[model samples]
Target chain A: MQPVQPLQSVTSAHTDRSLQLTLFIVSLVTASVLGLIVLFIFRETLPALSGPGMLRFVTDESWHPLENQFGMLPMLWGTLASTALAIFLATPLGIGAALFCRYFAPRPIVRPFRALITLLAGISSVVFGFWGLTVLVPLIARFEPPGASLLAASLILTIMILPTVALMSEAAINSVPESYSGGAAALGLSKGATIRQVILPAAKSGIFAAVILATARALGETMAVLMVSGNVVQTPGSLFDPIRTLTANIALEMAYATQFHRSTLFVSGLVLTFVIAALAIAAHRVEHRAGSHHAA
Target chain B: MQPDSSVSCAPGLMAAPSVAGSTLLTAQVHAKLSERLFVAAVWLAAALVAASFLWIVADIAFHGFAKLSWSFLTEAPRSSGRKGGISTILVSTLLILAVTVAVAVPLGVGVAVWLSEFSRRSSRTARVINIALDVLAGIPSIVFGLFGNAFFCVFLGLGFSIVSGGLTLACMALPILIRATESGLSAVPHDWRQGAAALGLSKAAALWHVLLPAAAPAITAGLLLGIGRAVAETAALVFTSGYVDRMPESLMDSGRSLAVHIYDLSMNVSGGDQAAYASALVLIGLLIVINAVAIQLSNRFMKSRIQPA
Candidate 1:
């Protein structure tokens, strides 16, 4: 029996070694896929990088690629400005929605609202684009001096990101123990006071992180913003003026562009990747930190 | 609907159990102001989400109805966005969905099962797998598109087709399903598995029937989420499912899904705003349907599965 046990144990150890090997290979493949994408983006954009007046790509605002003048300062400005507008519009709403869902809503009503929020989050950007073009454009046209402008794009984007922000914030809020709130209430604090002084502070890191991620989502958002932002390469002075986001530019032109024009698109994509990557890493770190605090 | 009741929870007066008037008054004013601010913020969020729904309905209703008769859904592609219905695209979406689920479920479940049930407690491989899944989840869709373009489109000579799109999407959603399934199985009560094994059930059999049934809701939730993501995706699908408007008679055939069609229409048709809006509405409607159905199932299944004993 002892001899047989030793043999069986050896076989089990052998199987374990192979299983570990399999998992290692999966990790390598996943990492390589990301590496490949970076390589391709850089590779595809090489032509534009090599082209004339390459230093002016950052400073030149007049982006007539056919004229071979590839300045993206205005495009960069448009992307940043619109993204800021969206973040500005979405932050308070997202936090409030999270607070309402987490602390305020009655038990019977919470589930359905949660479900709706989840559904909203799940809807496609293409669908959002479609909606923006059809519904939002007309709505904006009613209010705006000019129809389908930067404001319109920001509004659509703000809506698109609400669910993402709300859901994450709600999760963060939910993680704050009832004990904290209860203790505050017991100490003669009203519900509002308790939530503000005790709960919101506890969930601050999380809510901030959620806001950042929603910003990334806003920045990366393609289809809906494309349809309604009027696709103008120029920068906006007033909120109602037409504008284009960096993402909208890539998605719009990637299909037809060639030579320097194509590589410029790759540069925009690479720019987008770096921007989102920075945001993702930061948000991810905050989320992890929030999780540890939650566990504690 | 339930928001009003929450709003009525009077912020200031009931703040302290002692209920001092001065603090109460100040708190009330503070609460009133903040509450209004909160209301504005939350209402804006809710309004946008609600407007998204309205946009879909209004867009499709105005434009799509103008164009969509029975023929709109049942017809083929045309040069003008005005005439073509999404019949082939819709069908392809469904077919691709079916294939994706078929491919993804088994592969995801197998990996989940192997990891959750078979892994050594301290195995470095398990940690590697977890990290790999995390990195995979964070990857942008464009990368997946690039992969499909090179590996499937050029190297493998699959060309742009539903098969390639479905496969790529399957890869995208794989980590999601596998993670969810693992969490579900882990959530299964240990005693149930033990009891099953004591009753002469094998380890595999115990997991299959006894443990999995308990974990089914969670796995289903994950699958539904994946489906929602897959259905809504555009970038990767654009590359893999070539822009052919023809219906996919076989998995090998090239076609657009509803999403790609929307992108193609919006980008191409010079004044296709109406069509784009209409297409958006249809896509949003489909997304809504998926969400509603997933929620319904998740709710029903989760309720029944909660162990009373």
Candidate 2:
């Protein structure tokens, strides 16, 4: 029996080794794919880096490639301004909806309410953009002619990101122990006070994580923002002013751009990559903290 | 004189709990008003979400349902996608989705298995991988578009082909799949793993025979979500996949997807709004069906698992 046990243990150990090896290799491949993407984009961006010194790319707002200028300042500003508008509009509504679903909604309706939010999240960005182009732009035009403007794109983006924010916030709110609220209420605090003082404070990290995630979504949003932002490659003077995002620039002209122009587009992509990576890292840290706190 | 003094002293103490004065009344009124306002605000937010969902669905259905037909589904688009059906684009979208699923599922599930089944919860390697996935997931699709152009089309020499586009999408889908599979795997109770061990099964065997089967539904749901993403993607495909209207003859051949088709028809082509709306309907309809089927399948699988227990 002892001899047989030794042989079986060896075989099991062998299986374990192979399993670990397989998973490790696969994970390495997954990591490397990201590395490859970053390397490739950076490599292609080299030509633009050399041709138009990096400072000019950031400082110069004139993006006429034919004139040998590749400034991304205007598109950068548009992306930031529109993204800020979206975050501003989505934050309150998302937190409120999450709170409503978690605390206020009747028990039986909660499941369907969540399902609806999930469905909204699943809807394609292009569909949102399509709706924006046809409906939102037209509505905006009632107040401001030409309809396609920063405000229109921002509104569509707000709706697109609402589900993301709400869902994350709901999860955060749910993670706060029921005991916390019950304890507050036992002290004679009203329901509103219990939620606002106890639950909301406890879920603060989670709500912030949700906002960061939404910001990433809004900044990276492409098709929908493209359709309604009017594709004008300029800095907008006002909310109604037409402007183009970095994404729209790449989508609109990448098809025909050649040599330096092509590399310049790749540079814009590299810039976007860095900005999103920074946001993603921030969100990951907050989410990780929140998750660990919940586990504890 | 003694009775009056005692009564007056008692009144001040009782007033702390209940004052019939205007200040106390106003404070009560303020609390009630604010509470009501908070409730109303929450309700309004919920209503806004519901209203937005309905508006988008109703608008798409109203515009595209009439345009949906056998001819529309089966015919090739002509006149810069202004007329006819989206057959080629539909097929291209399917092909891209297939390629992405093939690449992403195995890789994602493998990493998830490693994290959940093999590694300790506090392992640094696992944490780094999770962070990597978070960053990967947050990356914009257009960045993938550029990466595809630089890596696959220009460098790898795949050119603007379906293969290149699909591989790029595979990158985008990877993080989503990994996260989904990880959650699913972890959701399987610890007892199952211990039971398998007590039966003297090897780690890999237990995972293959027990853990994976239990998590299959969740993993499938995740795959469905990734498929939806690949289907809806446009900006990335633009640079990786050439905007060819014809159905792809081979993996190397460039093709346009349904999402790209809608964008082109609406933006670049003149008087093609009808086709765009029809395509939007088909795309949205496809998404709804996918989501519904995924939900049904996962629920059924979970129910079946619960019934025997």
Say which candidate scores most in lDDT: 2
Model 2, B277-301: lDDT tens digits are 8999998888877777666766676
**In model 2, where do residues sit more than 4 Å from their true spots?**
A1-12, A291-296, B1-20, B295-309
lDDT by residue for model 2 over A204-259, one digit each (tens)? 99899999989988988888999999988788899999989988888888888998
Candidate 1 is graded, for docking, as acceptable
Interface RMSD of each: 3.8, 2.8
Model 2: DockQ vs. true structure: 0.61
Candidate 2, pairs of clashing residues:
none
Steric clash pairs (candidate 1): A60-A71, A129-A224, A188-B16, A189-B15, A190-B15
Q: At residue B290, what lDDT does model 2 achieve?
A: 78
- Candidate 1 residue lDDT tens string, A1-296: 23336665566556656755564454455445545666777777677777565787876657788877788888787888888998997787777777777766668867777777787788787777666765667777898755788888888888888887888888888889889988987776666667778988999888888888888778777777887888888878888888887777776666678767877877877777777767767887788898898787
Identify the CAPRI category of the predicted complex in candidate 2. Answer: medium
C-alpha lDDT score of every prediction, in listed order: 0.74, 0.85
